[model samples]
Target: MWKNEAEPSLLEILRKITELKLFPLPEYLSIITKRSNEEFEEDDSEDERDNLIDAWDEALKSSFKQLEKYADYISDNSSFGTHQGVKGLEFLRVMVILDDEEARGFLFSYEKLFGAKVLT
Candidate 1:
């Protein structure tokens, strides 16, 4: 369902999720969420909501077994390390790259560091 489209909307993703019956997703609430946002407004809330939904959709489509296999391969073959994971360890050469968009979890906020968001 996702292969042909260059980009798919939230409604389309919800339908695909329902069709696949992916466990733990709200199959019944697809009816509610897939409905058009009649109260649409020009604000960050909508964008934030879309980001969360997109994250869920992407996670659902990923294969856990494949991810584990890749993790094992990276552990065996690569020196790649996460920021916190690499702490206290030294390497011959170090390079740092910051990618806030792909960063998940609440450990650190690159948004605040880069001034995209203000500290509360």
Candidate 2:
């Protein structure tokens, strides 16, 4: 997912593009947030699973319709996702977003990764 602060900028960019009228607006645009492990574990009941499954099904249908409308754009543009989300996937190019929160993680030390001291 894009950083929370970057969401506004992304929306503005989308708004500008839509105003240009180069393409039709999608019938649906859903942003599904990645659930934390703790949250997922908490919803372990069968009823909760069923509800989540139904929601996912609806989302998938909407996504397919959107893809049909903008197949070219989808194919050309790079997908933005968290590291865990892109596991086992391969792409010609990938840009990793390492903000302050991610920088402090044990898996990726900013200083070690970039060979520069982290100011924080």
Candidate 3:
């Protein structure tokens, strides 16, 4: 869990994301976050890059094992899991996006559960 929120460099964050899910963010976001904006021409080194990616994958898997306790905390109906574990994961917090199942009677319960301002 700590590693997910660790202050790694930008590139390292992307690499950790790749480690979690082969390709983490949406295509557009990935392109924007990964592209390099440099003045000098850098050579491409396939071996080194591959090694780093592999290292990240191993590190992530290890971290996952350590934080195994909170795996089932999020309900299946929630959109927090497997979806955003890519880059930096934020646990203990979930976005209860409104849905049709949420009728007026359920508003107060949600408000109490999440301390959210439900205007119902």
Candidate 4:
């Protein structure tokens, strides 16, 4: 979903959460991607790859710090995670990202997941 057009909306939600001072400013907020940096790395020079890896490491560290900062609030609050990573966990608010074009199967279709009445 991150690669899709829904990224803007996702960023907007994060901005609103920060701007509105929601959930104690630092708590109940997290972002997880479906794939890691290594998985995303394509063809690149050694130096370029190293730089990219470093940047990804820094970002991961920052995310970890944010989670630690809000460790207390997370017990009953919400978190953003990929479906694969969130298995066996439950949240008060679970926002699933299902791209209309990407999720076309019977099980994934909007019509099946959310009936026609709800869609309208």
Pairs in steric clash, model 2:
none
Candidate 3 minimal-lDDT segment of 10 residues = 61-70
Candidate 2, residue 85: how far the Cα is off, in Å: 14
The TM-score of candidate 4 is: 0.20
TM-score: model 3 vs. ground truth: 0.21
Per-residue lDDT tens digits for candidate 2, residues 1-89, read 23564323323434445657656545332222233336445655566346554464343433322433344333544232235544445
> For candidate 1, what is the TM-score?
0.27
Model 3: CA > 4 A from native: 1-6, 9-11, 19-23, 37-120
As for candidate 1, its clashing pairs are none
lDDT of 1 by residue, 7-100 (tens): 4554455556666777545643453445445633222253546655555544434344334434554455423334664443467556555576
* Model 4 segments more than 4 A misplaced: 1-8, 24-120
Scored by Cα lDDT, where does model 2 land? 0.42
Q: Rate the local accuracy (lDDT) of all candidates.
A: 0.50, 0.42, 0.42, 0.40
What would the per-residue lDDT of candidate 3 be over residues 3-101, giving only the tens digit for each residue?
566535444555558667866676544543454545112424344554554443344333332233233334454333344223434666555453334
Better of 1 and 4 by TM-score: 1
- lDDT per residue for candidate 4 within 14-95, as digits (tens), equals 5455556575433223322333346435323455455544454344433322444344334434232224434445666664
Question: Which ten residues in a row are the worst by lDDT in model 2?
Answer: 27-36
lDDT leader: 1
What ordering of candidates by lDDT runs from best to worst? 1, 3, 2, 4
lDDT of 4: 0.40
| TM-score of model 2 vs. true structure | 0.24
